[model samples]
Target: MTTKHLNLKFSVKDTDAIRNMAKSGRTAYAIALWFIRQGRPVATDEVLRVCDDMGVKVRKSA
Candidate 1:
């Protein structure tokens, strides 16, 4: 068996926000899995909606 490598880039701010939410007692896995179940995703724009609902503050980046 072989494993493939993939690259994913998230802004420093978004990474920080994810960390903060975890620190604040939100289960990161739950958020991700919930979106997966909904056939949505963790894409920035989509995730931001979840973040906004969870009151997660995100710094914008392009």
Candidate 2:
């Protein structure tokens, strides 16, 4: 099989939008880590709840 390349173009507005989204994702990841480090089920539950509220779907890979 041959490798395929994809071409994508982002306008200024699109760049800004993705930047904000990436920033939010980073913040969410940090908060989740903090919750996990608390060693409390409640904290972890809260993190899952927030993720659900934000429509984040996680799947385990085998």
Instruction: Give the alpha-carbon lDDT of every model.
Output: 0.50, 0.38
Per-prediction TM-score: 0.37, 0.29
Which 10 residues in a row give candidate 2 its minimum summed lDDT?
A: 1-10
Q: Which regions of candidate 1 fall more than 4 Å away from where they truly are?
A: 1-7, 33-40, 43-62
TM accuracy, model 2: 0.29
TM-score of 1: 0.37
Clashing residue pairs for model 1 = none
The window of 10 residues in a row where model 1 has the poorest summed lDDT is 1-10
Give the Cα error of residue 38 in candidate 2, in Å. 9.4
Q: Write the per-residue lDDT of candidate 1 for residues 1-62, one digit (tens) a residue.
A: 11132214344454555657545655555545544665756654544554554456544342
Please name the candidate that would achieve the greatest TM-score relative to the true structure.
1
